[model samples]
Target: MNTTRTLIAAAIATVGTAAHAVDLKAGEWDIAIGGIVNAYYTHTSCSGSQAVGGAALATKGLGCGGTDGRTVIGNGLLPNALTTTAKTRQEGLDISATLMIGAAVASGDAISNNNNNVDVRQGFVTFGNADMGTVKLGRDYGLFGSSAILGDMTLLGAGAPVAATQRNRVTLGHIGSGYTYLGTYGQIAYSLPTSGGFSATVALMSPVDAGTAIGRNEPQLQALATARFGGGKAWLGVKRQKFEGTGGAASFTMNAAEVGASFSAGALGFAANVQSGKGLGVLTDGDSGNRKQTNVLLQATWQATAKTKFGLNWGESRLKDGAATDLRSNTNVTAGLYYGLTRSVTLVAELSRTTSKPVTGEQARMNGFALGGIVFF
Candidate 1:
């Protein structure tokens, strides 16, 4: 049998076997495992200097570049010091395992891999009940860290949002191959009982030391609230991060807020979001100038058929000199189509274009296209 068919059959058999085993259990203990495989090919074109080292650096003009500005696409697959290519070929597997012990102790881990290489995505334990809400300890999703409208669902390829755009400011920044370290973070989330087609969720998060950064005596806190009404949903979230006692040489704080909404009717869905933040540093002169940043996004999806879907996304980000005026900006547009080959497999193709304003005497533009497939089991 083909790989897709084999995986689907194995999943079905495993679930069936697990269900039978659970029926013989005396107490509440449950376990489940699942995974997804994604692969894609990408091509890209670029102009001017790309953003580098949190600052836009000079590029030797426009050309087709791989993942790390390597002249050869194969060389870009690995890490490099210069510009990181916005698009490249990649394949990976995301696996998740969950365990529940009675009604109080619950734990899970989500891991991803490029080929056989492992990357930890989530590892956390939870304690609580329906009436008391839940408290999660360890590394997990941060409060206000992700959007409810389209959680982690990116279309195939070159059109995918950059790592920064998809990141949750309430958590540590993403690094290396688009992975975010959960760090030492804890979360408390509560959902109110539904009434009249309305439901709400409020969450809070605190930082933990995951050893990613040492001697970093800083704390971060976040709050997020979301409400759903009929076919529409809205959310507001805020985060405050402080880095203290680095001998006043390099310490900074970031404050961010975001608002978003989404609506769905029939087979069509629409969503929009806006986020703003300021990064400030303390110096001998008392709080040197701050950097202001804003991001906005709009997206739409249509389930054209039982086996086909279409999507469009547009986003823009601007950075300024603390007055909320745009000093430099980046904008991107993407459109794509997906076709389901089976209940567990899909094929996708997409195109994307991005443009950036003048930064350090240069302008940058990039365009790319991609095609790929994904299988879930």
Candidate 2:
């Protein structure tokens, strides 16, 4: 009986040791993979030129037979011809994915990755903790590139005019259309620990060169601070970029700054943002000339029920004189509503209208509407 009891105790100890060894050396990593699939039907109403039979066709020329006068071909294929009409139609899907990995780091050292082939969604490695803040490096969001009130909800496609513009501002570090800006360069950010519901972050990013002439441009710097008081939150931010070359033979610099606030009460939220800056051509209009601009956006959101929310937004941008007027000034208004279909799925419908007046005596207006569903995993 004594030998049997001793054998059992020894076996238990051996098993415990093996479990500890596995826990220490195996599966010590954490991985998270997520994706969003947004399928939408879009309709637009705008008067624009269309193509017919591989040739530019006037708006009135649409629906006409090709210049070759050939209409029917085998399998509905254009026999040496094609045709297009300026008809509003519906379109398909927009999908994106993201993967994140994190691991324990030793003091003074951090985890890093090549980030190759990864979509421009997000990629970064942070070391340290709240006490000492943290050092983050890799492709990531730029400081001051987004307003706090808007940044928090960018994933849902709502934000300030500047924030929305930043998504397509190529020379300003935005990756491009249909992709999130990863900033493909180095970034250093420090996030102060939350204190009394207030926090701040300051970050700097290396300049992204668009060409040889712009290769030597100075680095981009941004500073953002946010404070929450009562039921309202206010934020202030600044961003600067120095173009490398002389503009119109005049050597100068470009800068931009923004301030915004948001307040909430019960089921309603109100937010407003304003930005004024110089040399924003890096993102708007894309001219190397010096220019000053201001943009403002106001939004309101209401939660009518636990599963539904509605939003309205209005935005406008104006370019100061001495700037090219081809792009002119524009105003946009968007209204949207979303309903939660499930824990991981949502249905959204939105309508947007834009009006522009160009300095070249051209006036245009566009209206677009989209209905979509987003599935997350």
Candidate 3:
């Protein structure tokens, strides 16, 4: 697969259950395991008779028998996922290992690649404590862009289009819709001792080899630092990689940087961030591997009642090009509601609209609404 395909696969699997590992004491290993299953009823409509990529179709939604609209039982932002963790103490130090897997939900042939075949999302081990700091080694999410995802309100439902046809009905939380996803990788990460609400993270990651690009022999550095105080927190992250092309193609380099801030008081919360870089991979996950891009995100939420919350968010992802005729930007707007049905079940509803505009000034639009619930075990 190419970089775009690799990135799409990664982003498509973003809807994860993230069950709190259930602890089952088994000898020296405290085996904790759990999983979650989520699905949604989606109704999407298009302004024109074409699907995302100009594919000719009926007037109704994919399954609705018309090209202008489609309706199907879809997977929301959270997919069926399972997580297991084992922890113990050694030499007066704490140690632990975790394994997380997830897949899409559907009957489509492609769903097998995205859903039925479980993919390992997290496989890592950590060692150490407060005084000794901490060390982590394995495959997991890159430190960059994680904070932005953590604050996104789309965790409970679908926010962005994962597929052009939209039959799968599942997608990553606001990725490419409200922000960009940071590709996961294998790395050795270390956390410095915290001081006065300040902490730092540093990792040496295996060079990215998504698609046909070659992995650099040297490790890439990923760094992040944050400060938390009172009702707000701020963070910054940076990463750099040099890619060797396959098939004797030209080699290239990528550099990425992102900064974000979050605040909360009483029943109100807010977050904002901006990221920019060249060859850092957005939309294509470095497929082109040389496109310059920038993203800006803004969001806010209100806990209106003990069991109800309301939120609205907006974001824009822009690609800088040498020629004005090339692709320029994709913008999104979203509003949603979350209501607790019970401690273990939550009801979710969301509406979103996205527009893609090229330098030629033409625009293509897509709008979607998702209704779903998250059931925790």
TM-scores of the models, in the order given: 0.64, 0.65, 0.85
Local distance difference test scores for all models: 0.42, 0.43, 0.67
lDDT of 3 by residue, 142-201 (tens): 777776766677767677533333344356556664456765689899988777888888
Query: lDDT-based ranking, best first?
Result: 3, 2, 1
lDDT tens per residue, model 1, 240-313 = 66644333444446677778888879988788777666641110001222456666777788888877878887
Q: Worst lDDT window (10 residues) for model 2?
A: 73-82
Q: Evaluate model 1: give its lDDT.
A: 0.42
Candidate 2 residue lDDT tens string, 126-198: 5544466545555554555354222222234322112111111201111111111222346666667667767
Best by TM-score: 3
Residue runs of model 1 more than 4 Å from their true location after superposition:
1-27, 49-117, 148-158, 161-218, 245-250, 280-290, 322-327
Residue 129, model 2: Cα distance from true site in angstroms: 1.7
- Estimate candidate 2's alpha-carbon lDDT, on a 0 to 1 scale: 0.43
Off by over 4 Å in 3: 1-21, 48-68, 109-115, 165-169, 210-212, 247-249, 322-325
Error of 3 at 282 (Å): 1.8
Count of residue pairs whose backbone atoms collide, per candidate:
2, 1, 13
